[model samples]
Target: MRGLIAAAVGALIAGNIAAAAADNSFAVRDVRVFDGDKTIPLATVVVEDGRIAVVRRDAPIPAGLMVIDGHGKTLLPGLIDSHVHVFPGAEADALRFGVTTELDMFDISRDFKTWKAQRTSLGRTGQADTWAAGLGVTVKGGAPLEMLPPGMSVPTLDSAADAQKFVDARVAEGSDYIKLFIETLSEYHDRRTMPTLSRAEVCAVVAAAHADHRLAIVHTQAEWAAREAIECGADAIAHMIPDRVVGTHFIALAKRHHIFFETTDDVWAGASGMDFAQKLARDPRVAPYLSPMQRATLLATEKKVTPRFFPTVLANTRALHAAGVPLLAGTDSPNPATAHGVALHEELQILVRAGFTPQEALHAATALPDAIFHLGRRGRVAKGYRADLLLVDGDPTTNIAATLSINRIWMNGYPVDRTLPKK
Candidate 1:
């Protein structure tokens, strides 16, 4: 009986090992794995189906599994561009740049639904995973309504009662979270009217969003407006205002409220150089992202408008970093000066320039954003995590530029064509 039992136990252990090995079918050999946290030199990452199975250094090779020789390469979690507008133009190239997951912070409900369906289909065809908040909630004659192109929905709330109805309509339309734009005093002056939403009304919208278990991300540019939005229980601030110096009080409040800051410092920097049309358009680096047609439109829109308030912006970004607010990577893409996907990498560079270590800046673009979105399956290289990863030629931890030096992107375990090369 003892001999029989011993044989059975040995067989059971063998079965378990086989199952574990079976789980790790997608393996990359001799690659340096930077698991979005620390470096594992000369490691192998085995991903089965669409999930990570194991990250082992010098582990035994499983039989009959596909392996890619990652010689002189580094493997890291695929980047997440937390804020982007993907309606048109270079948005598809985000995958080529190593942006595997993108969060669309604004777009109309109907359009968002269509985009989401298309993204789902593309996923079946092996594309990047895309998610969004359907159309930002704003006042009837608000900023987005004034700036965005035609066909974009801008639901405006006039009073506190109107705010509640607007919130309900957005939730019904499948908005992931509520986006608000609180007007600054200067903006109110330029528009030549009193701001529509009162403090109480804005607060009501925040309350309504919370009741529905959705977060509220506010587009506020001034210190006072930011404070008001925070007081109303906003979950995040979408931009770092360069117009005003943010004090420690605001930082303390932000920390207390657990508010995440999307420091779109790069967009501001790029937009600042728009006044020098010849310099901006003729420059080789900026030309690819900007078109002749778009430059003509920009020259017409704000022809005489020189770049505004740059020093303050740098200071605001610096202060935010010092304050320890959970910084998020975002580029207001498809905007006048910034393009999609490519611009996100520029944001990472700017963050690194503003005193962030390469690791921290990369985290903002990868692991941190996933954590912010409560996306459990995406980011990191652990068992059960999504196989969204980038294979690069050099170690990105040593230099920021190495982050964009992509060899290939594995989206849900399928290779993405970097050059959009012909079949």
Candidate 2:
């Protein structure tokens, strides 16, 4: 009789273990779902095996699945910051601000691949998915030459033949898009100003990139270079030129070619010369980084441009929005002025003020950017989309600022720890 009881107990334990394994699904219940257009209440989203298996209204909980009681929280597709430069601790900051995906515009291929791998590992360990464009290929001494320290400048080819060689080398090195930097005609013409690639050189780079099935994003102000970039089939304009109003021609062309625009107007609108002058004069975060000469320049900018010059910057961005071109959210983060993470949220708020509806701004941050980059399996909350999503305490459809109050983030169906304190 004892032998019979032992065998029966082993059979019962095996059945219970199998039942627990089957119950490993997750159900997020009673949440407000922002289904990319409208918000619906009392929605339940189910995830199993890292995919959203079901979305139903007032659905009963499936046995064995873990349930996340939403407590009337708002749910939306995870935010995407189309352009940023990542540094340490960016993952934490992104989750805190509801940014589920971040794209770096100028990272080395090897380092970028490593970052991508680590980001995937972070997702497995519950962090946001991180992506980057491997490097910005520019004329060695062009616009970036203006900012880079001596000896660190990337190469600038003199002739179209040299440009082809440069392009070939970069492709072999695994670059994503060829990034050309054009600031002024003088920079190209006058070697003293900043040695820039000739027009033929630029065209050669673009052609090479296209031949290799890559795109080109040119960093240029409105000028001959900008016009030339458009004519040469550049995939995107990195920023909106503020010096002159862009005419209907570029807009019509952009629409026709499906070219994208990343209006990084936030960097210009939120110029920190005045604020940083004050902060560098006294604050702890920046004072350490400033040399005495750098501090002097910051102080001088406040006296020169703070009150009168900023209005023009705001006016230009407003005009760009009226053009109805495809605008992507880019913060120019990790730069000296714009802070990373929360800065993209601020950029979205600025975008809304610049004439986009809350939904439109959210769309720019999510769907529009994803579509532009051809990033598959991200930027949505549908059944087949990657499980990159966020939860908020308030309805974003009502108040877009609720996006700033990110409560939880899920990347690849794994819960990431909130950088902000839990409510």
User: What are the per-residue Cα lDDT tens digits for candidate 1 across 1-423?
Assistant: 999999999999999766544442468898987776667788888877767888888765668666788888889888888777655433455666677777777775345565557444324223455677777776677756666667655557877777767888888887777887776445223555435467887798898888888888888766788888888889988887755677888888988988888877765665566333344445454445344333443233222323554456677777777788888888766565555555666778778777888788888888888787875567787777878888888887768767656776777766665544332
- Against the reference, the lDDT scores of all candidates come to 0.70, 0.64
Give me the runs in candidate 2 sitting further than 4 Å from their true place: 1-25, 37-42, 116-123, 146-153, 185-193, 272-322, 419-423
The clash count of every prediction, one per candidate, is 2, 3
Lowest summed lDDT window (length 10), candidate 1: 297-306
Pairs clashing within candidate 1: 107-135, 140-156
Please provide, for model 2 over 267-309, each residue's C-alpha lDDT reduced to its tens digit, 9 standing for 90 to 100: 5553423252344235443344333333443344322233432
Runs of candidate 1 with Cα error greater than 4 angstroms are 1-25, 88-91, 109-126, 150-154, 184-196, 274-308, 421-423
Query: What TM-score does model 1 achieve against the real structure?
Result: 0.82
